[model samples]
Target: MPPLSMPSIPQSAEPAASRHAAPVAKNRRGLETRERVLAVTRGLISAHGYAEVTLDQISAEAGVAKSSLLWHFGSKEMLLAEAATSLFRQIGEELGAEPHHGRTAARRLENSFDRVADYLTANPEAKGVVLALLFSGSVPASVREEIRRGWDSHVQDLVAALSAPGRPLPAPMARLMIATIHGCYCHWYASDRSEPIAAFLAPARELFADWLRSRDR
Candidate 1:
């Protein structure tokens, strides 16, 4: 089958209008170019470490001119910033496995965490980007800040979920859970993900259940 051009992505994935943002293309070909660059970015970054994947390789692999790469993305840093956001948003979509109604807040949180853990296991390239940009001091400071922002939205979403009533979780605890989840993610990937990634999320689920029991008692 022929490749689809510009398939709908989450609204949060839209490229920004500013130079620091993903290239905002207007024309059909222009949009296609951006998609190709992002695909190559994800693929190569997954195969190699984030710092090792360069714009020269992305441009060559995506079949776009080096100048075209620049025309779409002001710099490689900006491209990776956008690609990280894109990958994260894709993971968010993966978390929405079931209908919200009839699901307990703890169950929902568990599912979301499980989804994130599983995603990192499956997409090692994107995981490498997370490790290099967020964990390792390999990227420029400006890019590091951008990568941090990319991680915040989903965490904020998790915080919102934790705040739901009926033994609502405290914000501090929600933040702690998310922080721990990130730590586990680092450990899981660093160890080659030998075991199921969701195994790391079991503690968060247990915590939520413990809180629920306390509230019921």
Candidate 2:
């Protein structure tokens, strides 16, 4: 499999006039304020879960006014959606930055596992935010749909990379691989870093590799 690269989120069609209008570029300060709001949202969601987090808390923690938050993101749901999308995009870019090195497909899969383990280890809060969103029951349907779209994009990329000539991987198998990867991360997180994430993922990695080899045979 090649390096994993996620597809961009699909945007809705804009009005003809809006499409023709010049894009308003944000200044450095505006950009920074936007990022600060996003960062604060992610942190709060990771620590308290999406259902428990409030716009007031984010505004206070980010040192931005509530009106500014609304101005940047329009609504709470949009803010959370953008935050999750940004995290997924960041992960995809980092994964795509380095090429996987291995002699065989199975080995390449293991290499990808290593890369994920390293990334999650470095960005534990990312795992927290993702899992929190996944398990939360109170997320708005619109927000949940956005998250699903981002997740499906990631899964589609992995499935494409893992498929062989004239043989596409089943979407379910791709989902299984992703679930196992997150399961390993959950265990490692629960253990409080007592065990390395790589160790937690090793068995599942080998299992996936074996399954891939079986299909090839």
Largest TM-score belongs to which candidate?
1
Candidate 1, residue 205: Cα displacement in angstroms equals 3.6
Candidate 2: residue pairs that collide: none
Cα lDDT of candidate 2 equals 0.74
Model 1 lDDT per residue over 96-133, tens place: 44566776676776666666766666665564565556
**Worst lDDT 10-window in candidate 1:** 17-26
What's the TM-score of each model vs. the native? 0.69, 0.66
Local distance difference test, each candidate: 0.68, 0.74
Which 10 residues in a row give candidate 2 its minimum summed lDDT? 95-104
After superposition, the stretches of candidate 2 with alpha carbons farther than 4 Å from their true spots are 1-65, 72-81, 93-104
**TM-score, predicted candidate 2 vs. hidden true structure:** 0.66
Count of clashing residue pairs in every prediction: 1, 0
